[model samples]
Target: ITVEEGLEEEEITLPPLLIQPYVENAVIHGLAKKAGGGTVAVHFQRDNGALAVTVRDNGLGFRQEEGQAPSIRHSSVGMTITQKRLELLGSA
Candidate 1:
């Protein structure tokens, strides 16, 4: 796991847990199932007056599953919560 921060603004405030779910997803779902494991790269960039976070992993890409898996459900929960949080923050 590698974290790269390239923020144009030195000090920026962020809401709680805004970026953690994505980083966790990158590790848990993306890199954990690889043959010899893989790299999870997280980048934080400030663009204009907003923040852009990217979580990238070099691992096995998506494959078709027969049915809904537990991991899929877990991911959905995390993403759903994160999406709502983003919406709330945006409205604030």
Candidate 2:
């Protein structure tokens, strides 16, 4: 995890909580789909007035057409929850 400091004077804003789960899912479940190990990159930066966090994995990515089942351990909760959480944040 990467952390930035020197923000006490600035406001403390947080990304949607569901996004947290999305990140975890990407690292855990996404990598499991791959045969061997892969790298998971997480980028944290300030964009305009908001914080931007990007989670990327080199593992096998998902394709919607597959309609594959969600991992029993991980579920598809990350995607579903993250999307809804982002929507709520937009309204706020």
Highest TM-score, which number? 1
**TM-scores, each model vs. reference:** 0.69, 0.57
In Å, residue 87's CA in model 1 sits off its true spot by 0.3
- Cand. 1 Cα-lDDT: 0.67
- Candidate 1, residues 1-92, lDDT tens digits: the string is 33335544455466788778877777777777778988878776666656667788886656566333234544257867888888877832
Instruction: Report model 2's TM-score to 2 decimal places.
Output: 0.57
Tens digits of lDDT, candidate 2, 1-92 = 45346434255456647457756777676787678778877666666757766788776676676654254333466677667777887922
**Which stretches of model 2 miss by more than 4 angstroms?**
3-12, 63-75
Show pairs that collide, candidate 2. none
- Please report, in order, the local distance difference test score of every candidate based on alpha carbons: 0.67, 0.64
* Best of the candidates, lDDT: 1
